[model samples]
Target: MKLVVLGAAESGVGAAILAQKEGYEVFVSDMGSIKPRYKAMLDAHHIAWEEGHHTEANILSADEVVKSPGIPETAPMVAKLIAQGTPILSEIEFAGRYTDARMICITGSNGKTTTTSLIYHIMRKAGIDAGLAGNIGHSLALQVAEAPHSTYVIELSSFQLDNMYKFRANVAVLLNITPDHLDRYDFKMQNYVDAKMRILQNQTADDTFVYWKEDEHVPNELPKYSDPSAKCGFTDEAQPGSAGYAANGTFVVNAPVHFEMPLSQLSLPGRHNLRNSLAAAIACLAAGVSPEVVRQGLSDFPGVEHRLEKAGTVNGIHFVNDSKATNVDACYCALESMTTPVVLILGGKDKGNDYAEIMPFVKQKCRALVYMGADNSKLHANFDATGLPTADTHSMRECMEHAVALAQPGDTVLLSPCCASFDLFKNMEDRGEQFKAWVKQYGEAK
Candidate 1:
């Protein structure tokens, strides 16, 4: 069997190794440059690969292709493969074929990371064996091939969910869906929502589907036919006759195993995170993890690095690295979570962002705006109507410098760009790391 691995990054490389180990003839092809480390691995494992181009002959000859989640199905090569009747699968799907571990998959627009991490933390605290993979770190295929665990908590993006067919999560979570990655989804909200709903595909009546009851997307667009025998809903706004909801400064999960936690004690900030934690707790409960473990995990889980991370303070101004705020809705969560006045750094490759959603918060909490990106004209057009003070910076350093000068002692300089970071930095992680390094020298906050 010939397995062609598309792309040569983490997921691709991992898939290549796993396919080769599975006694298949694996060839990794990347249209972009493959990192030296991954290239070295290919050579070390004696696995064949080609970088800088995807050779049509080699790719077309494969029996199956393992695609990176970042590669959209619309890519010409992918379209051609589909036309030729070649089965294309995501790294997660390809990996799922080798693992017997029960997958606990989580997906959503805004809070999937928080929820995934929260569930993993809860499992560890509860003394259950679990491994984290998928959209976050090590490729699931690689993990399952090398060090298999009994339970896997995987973060599923819409792209990953798209190529997945029989890879069902024993307990699936959909935090909430919103308008995001519309360009990839044909600018249709339903398209993206439907892709996210695929996390529950192939799930049996014995499985549990966890979702948010109050999200407009859930009660409206959610497919009832995809119902697992059990349903658990998490909400901060809904009345909880059963399941979970937030009330009186606490999140209450009522059911087979009663759970409640003070809102203030949650390690993660923001109402979105509160809802995310609630959803994760419900998932853990459904998985049969104990309440004590859930409580400990909710209280002590270290938040994801790039999502609303506190970089440092200089001249009494705090810098927050929210490089993960890649959409308007994610940015809304960052702005709404601010306690101190914010000097928000915003701009990037606009993914058809509708800035109107965050205009109210920008006008109220934002003391100043530092627009970072080459094409910040869209922000200007949308923000001009808001009358918020705005200035432009072509680079991240300039944005940070101007932000420091403009910020007061008790204010925050938030690098919460409401778009993808490719325009300025290599990726969100690179952007976030640069923010952290620069803030280390700033002598403002302890």
Candidate 2:
């Protein structure tokens, strides 16, 4: 069969490689310049690929297409393919077709990376032959092509879930749903919610759906499910019949075998992380992993980078890199986790964020605010009347300088932008790495 892959980055290149390995006629195309390493791979493998432009004729000849999650459905090329009645599959869907691995897929607006990593940690601790894929580690298609494991802990995004149809998760984890990435969803909450619900699409009675019980959008959506038995719900607050809950600094999961651990033992902090812990633990237990393994994984997991990761402490001021906090909700979690007064770095490509959601936390916890992005007018306007000292800058260096000036001995300098990083940095990881680098170079120098 002719297989065409779009956006020749990690996932797309991986899919092309897997398709070629499976004896399919493969062609890869990217509208932007393909990275040198990826171009080399295509050349070495003798697979056909093109960069900086899409040849419509070549792409149109495919029997199937694998699309990278980064591409929006609204792209002219994609829309043209849709008009031609050609089916498009996400990298996860294309990769899933070739593997018999038990899929443990995790998705949410936030906390997904942490939960996915934690689950992967627990599965390995249990001596399970597992591979980390999806949004976190290597591309699933690449892993399936080279060394496929018996199980996979996949960190899925709503974009990845959108094009997935027949791919079923043995264990599906829905962390929470909030207003995020609405621009891609036509500025509709229901559309974004529908995209997230696709994770449950191919699930069956034997499959487990572990989700956050307290999420505002989840309960309303749960009624559509015909079977409640498949659900393993969790909450940070007490919910008597929930599969997991946190109380008195302890996280308790009542499934497979009852287990409990003090919240103090959890490597990640904040109430949001407590909720992430519950979802990961319940999913692990449902996968037949012992409670002991879950406990060990929860305790030993250092934490995922860019999600409230501690950069360093200098002159009694703590620096935190939460560059992954790309939405109002994520920033709320970061703010809530702060024990000391915060010199918050906020602003980026605003995703129609409602800053009102975080205003309460900001009023209570924020010592000063530094706005950094291609545009900072919205933030300055919204925060000006709050009477909390605020400064605006366009670069990460200026952001740190303002933060350093505002920070005191017991202050925390946090880079939780609450918006997309594309305005200033390549992505969240790039933003986070720069934050850490600057903190180490400049902040620690003092």
Candidate 3:
């Protein structure tokens, strides 16, 4: 069989190697320049790969294709594959066929990384042989091809779910769905919601589904995708059907076994994090992790970087890097968690975001606003009428200066841009690192 892997990054390279190991004639292609590290991996594997261009003849001849989640279906090459009815699969799907590991999969608009990490930590603490994969760590294909484990914890994105067909999760977790990446879904909420619901597909009666019972979109869409016989668990306040819940400042899990832990002992803060913890606890419990292991893991786990991460304090002012809050709902959660008055830095590539979703939190918590992006016109259009002091900036350095000026002692300067970072940085990580760098530089000068 001839297999062509699209986009020679982590997932693509991993897919190529896996296909080669599986005895398929494999080729890798990326329209963008492949990173040096990925290029080295492909070379070491003796795999054929092309970068900065896609050879249409070679790609169109594939018996199957594994596409990187980052490449949209709207890409010309992907469209051609669809038109020709070629089988297209995500690396996760391709990797799944090679391993029988117990899969613990997580997806949502926010809190997925933290929840996925928390579950993995608990599983490890309980001495389960586990590998972390999907969107958070090493690609699943690479791990399956090189170092397979007894179980795998995966953090999936909507894009990856779109291409997955036969993959099944033994323990599936859908944290909460919100309006994120709507641009990729053609600005339709249902299309994005449908993509998220794919996590529950191909489940059996023995499989488990964990979800946020209170999410606006989850409840409405649950019946459409969830298997009737699959065991369903929900995160909510302790109730008749709740699998995990928080009540009286205590986190509780009832299914698989009864368990409880003090909410105050959880390492991550904020109401949103409380939900994340609940979801993670449910997933761990469903995976048969013991209560003692879950409790210790929840308390000892350090928070995810670039998601409400403390940069540093400068001249009595606090700086928070929330570069992962790349959508309006994520910024809303960050704002909802702020106790101190905030100078909220927001702006980037707008993804058809309705800023109105966060206006209430902005009015309640923010003292000022800083717009940082190649274009801030949409931000201004939405926020200029808020009657708050605002500054427009095109660079991180300028953004920090304005935020510092706007903030006072005891104030917090938060970088929770409610839009994608592509306009000004390589990605969310670059945006966050730059924010931390500027904060450190300013602190030293102070």
TM-scores of the models, in the given order? 0.96, 0.97, 0.98
Mind giving the per-residue lDDT tens digits that candidate 2 earns over 88-127? 9999999999998899999999999999999999999999
**Number of the top candidate by lDDT?**
3
Off by more than 4 A, model 1:
223-226, 237-242, 444-446
Kindly list the per-residue Cα lDDT of model 3 for residues 72-189, writing each as its tens digit.
8899999999999999999999999999999999999999998999999889899999999998899899999999999999999999999999999998999899898999999999
Q: Give the Cα lDDT of each candidate.
A: 0.86, 0.90, 0.91
Q: After TM-score superposition, what is the CA distance of residue 316 in candidate 3 from its true location, in Å?
A: 0.7
Model 1 residue 81 lDDT score? 99
- Backbone clash pairs for candidate 3 read none
Compare candidates 2 and 3 on lDDT and give the better one: 3
* Model 3: lDDT of residue 165: 95
List, residue by residue over 1-446, the lDDT tens digit for candidate 1.
99999999888888989999999999999999989999998899999999888899999999999998888888989989999999999999888889888889999898898789889989988888899998886778878878889999999899988898878789998988888888898888888888987877888887888888888777676566656547777668547454787788887888546978888888887788888988888899889988888888899999998999988766677889999999999999999999999999999888878888998999899888889998999988888676666788988678888888778999999988989888878998888898888788555333
Better by TM-score, candidate 3 or 2 = 3
